[model samples]
Target: MSQPSDKALVPFVSVDHMMRLVHRTGLEEVLRGLADYIEADFRRWELFDKTPRVASHSAEGVIELMPTSDGEVYGFKYVNGHPKNMKEGLQTVTAFGLLADVGNGYPVLLSEMTLLTAMRTAATSAMVAKYLAPKGATTMAMIGNGAQSEFQSLAMKAICGIDTVRLWDIDPAATAKCAANLAGQGLRVVPCASAEQAIEGAQILTTCTADKQCATILSDNMVGPGVHINAIGGDCPGKTELAPGILTRAGVFVEYPPQSRIEGEIQQMPQDFPVTEIWEVIAGRKAGRVKPDQITLFDSVGFAIEDFSALRYVRDRIAGTDLFHPLDLLADPDDPRDLFGMVQRAAPER
Candidate 1:
């Protein structure tokens, strides 16, 4: 037997390895770095291949493939969302991803995306808030204290200078857990009794509840002027966090309109509803929060380009480091046309 060639080996980041990498680089640093990558990609949003995530929905959940490319490299994530999974002691969302060279379509990296997705989602939120949130904002109300709650809080603290996070959830235990996890993390973690209390005095309101129905976490009157809403949990069809009146009044920003129209908070709006892509705002083609009194809403649906940027960031950071293991994920032959010969030569005593 021969060792696999470098070309045949792909860098793999397991859950353990990904955690180690996060700790080694510092979670705050990783979040900021991922924001840098995401911002860069969003600045040049026209180059990448963009499409809505292909989703297969069932009574219980949805499985989706989010794929995008930037000419040189391509990336995609396989993710599933099963809100009921928590009842069975499983994560509501789990994911893995791959990156490949577009030239030959050979995989360059294979990694766990569950953690990466959390980090990227937080980073993307903070990034959008950086652009849309009121200047000098220090408090964020995080509704739905699930797996994403802590990450979102920390990212806001790290990237957007948010010093306080007010948390609430349908399950008080979840809020307790999130508050406990965020203790001594350089931010004030406040567990509120109701959604209105959570948003009180919060300049940024982030709703990331794990529900599959058209539930309104924030009503129109609940949202006052001069607030930025980062609505993330309502990411698929039939799920929404904000009320229609909120959408009617706030200046809405989205990742991609086609997908957001079907999957984000805008799903509750009209098909011809006007919205601005965040990329356009980042590129200065559109306005962000023009005035402090204007309410801004970012209808984030977790675009493929964000996953692509996260994968690229991970691939670049893991270079010359022991954060990843090599896996023989590709079949490579000395002679490209003699793949059969290469395989037959390896068979013994047949």
Candidate 2:
């Protein structure tokens, strides 16, 4: 067999490799790095192609294709959300993604994105909290303790200086799992019996449930003044975590207003319901949290640009490291127009 050319290769990061990469750079540092990249991209938000994720929904779950390009590089992620998978001892969410050079349309990076998604989601939450959470905030209420709960807790601790996390979930085992994972991570972990107890004295409230329906994991009555709400589980139509009244009372910030209106907490409200893009706030073009007593909400539904940023970050991080495998994902013919000839020439080796 003949060796393939360099152009035929693509860097692939597996789940194991992703974990190693995270450990190599240090988890908290990687979280901070992702947050920086995401924030930087958001500051130049208008330069990218922005659109809602293309989704295929069914009774079982939904599969989505989130794609975007910053004129130089194009990236996309294939992710799925199936709430019932947990009962069957499977992951509720799973994903993989790719980044390509737009000039040549050749893939540059391919990576498993299930774990990356969790990390970026938490980083984004913390980044937004850093901008909107009250001054000197140190405690956060983690309203759900599932696959994403621990990451969310650590991200807040790393990025927002949150020293304590109050956790609550419908399932006690989930809370126990999250707590066990968080041990010795430097934060005071508190397990609560109810969602109401979790939010007590918590300056930041993060709700990340897995259910695919319109579930009110955080009610208006449960929320108090001067808290930043990070609602991430409310993704896709009919899936939400915050109450309608809460949206009405808070200053809602979103990644992209068009996508959020269809898939975020605002889906429960009227079409004309107002929302401020977090990029505007980050860019100093709009206000984030004006008053100490005012409520702030980051209605995050996982935008494509964030994934693009993650792909970009991963590509840079794995530059000289063995944390990624080189995959022969493309056909590199000696002559660009000789694809058929190359295939025909391969019959002898077969």
Candidate 3:
């Protein structure tokens, strides 16, 4: 038999190409597809090898590494959260990620994840909403209208059937940009002046604010019964969005308890605080939305499995598009036993 043609190298996807992939497929389609992948991963939760995220922090910001494996494949992303960077015309966060074949510890792909992170984050939030939010929920209160606002709005419109979004941001310009970017997405955007005004009469409340400290964007008094809270930005230790009282009254749900307890809104509660893990609910081992009066909280710290799903989803959608680029991050030896030879082949010039 003839030897197989040299397999094409792994594609390296850039921010520009990824955005096109997202735009062409339509945001709703992407969210719907991504939710399926995320939910599938949740069903096979036991199949995954997970670890708490690793973080390196400075006074200005935090850089995190989230890694996970499903025996066959492994992936990780390097992401930073710096709320102050935007003032200097830099992104508040910058990211890149890699997917590897764990069987050989070889990197198969590299891609810019800054924009991808926004997409994945919104996708994950919508996934939780589909399973936890009340049926036929069409209105959402999106707190913090910054870089993530447009993506969250798009995801909700695409997956949750949300046709109207109530937007609130401390900065009016941020809200304006959010509305402007989302023009003609087939949703009604209502800009509000305060957090309370935004949450009014909305079934879903998404807090994607970037304050680096514990700030109450939503108070206990503002939250009503049956509202699904998608808390996205309270991901780091000191950062939070909901008041402590709010968590106490809600039937809190988290992605991973151990990591979430340290990083989620549950951190404010006692060590023995009762909360449901979303995977159990998705697997039907636990109940979700048992009552209309139940205030469900998805304390989203943005888990690794979600990122795994996103990377996999992007890979499939952009397969033949040449939207990705390959990086020489791993070694492929002609002979498996010639490890030394591979090292010598890659040595620096004399």
The alpha-carbon RMSD values of the candidates against the true structure, listed in the order shown, are 0.9, 1.0, 3.2
Instruction: Write the residue-wise lDDT of candidate 1 on 231-250 in tens digits.
Output: 99889999988899999999
Shift of residue 21 alpha carbon in model 2, Å:
0.4
What order do candidates take by lDDT, descending? 1, 2, 3
Models 1 onward score TM values of 0.99, 0.98, 0.93
The residue-by-residue lDDT of candidate 2 on 1-350, one tens digit each, is: 47779999999999999999988899999999999999999999999999889999989999999999999999999999999998999998999999999999999999999999999999999999999999999999998899999999999999999999999999999999999999999999999999999999999999999888899898889888999999989988989999899999999999998899999999999999999999999988999999999999999999998899998899999999898988988999899899998888777753
- Please give, for residues 151-265, the per-residue lDDT of candidate 3 as tens digits: 8888888888899999999999989999898889899999998998999889999998888899888888999999999998888888888999999888899999889988888
Q: Backbone clashes in each candidate structure, one number apiece?
A: 0, 0, 8
Better of 2 and 3 by TM-score: 2
User: Candidate 1: lDDT of 87?
Assistant: 96
CA lDDT for candidate 3: 0.86
Task: Identify the runs in model 1 with alpha carbons over 4 angstroms from their true place.
Answer: none
**lDDT agreement with native, every candidate:** 0.94, 0.93, 0.86
- By TM-score rank, best first, the candidates go 1, 2, 3
lDDT (Cα) of model 2: 0.93
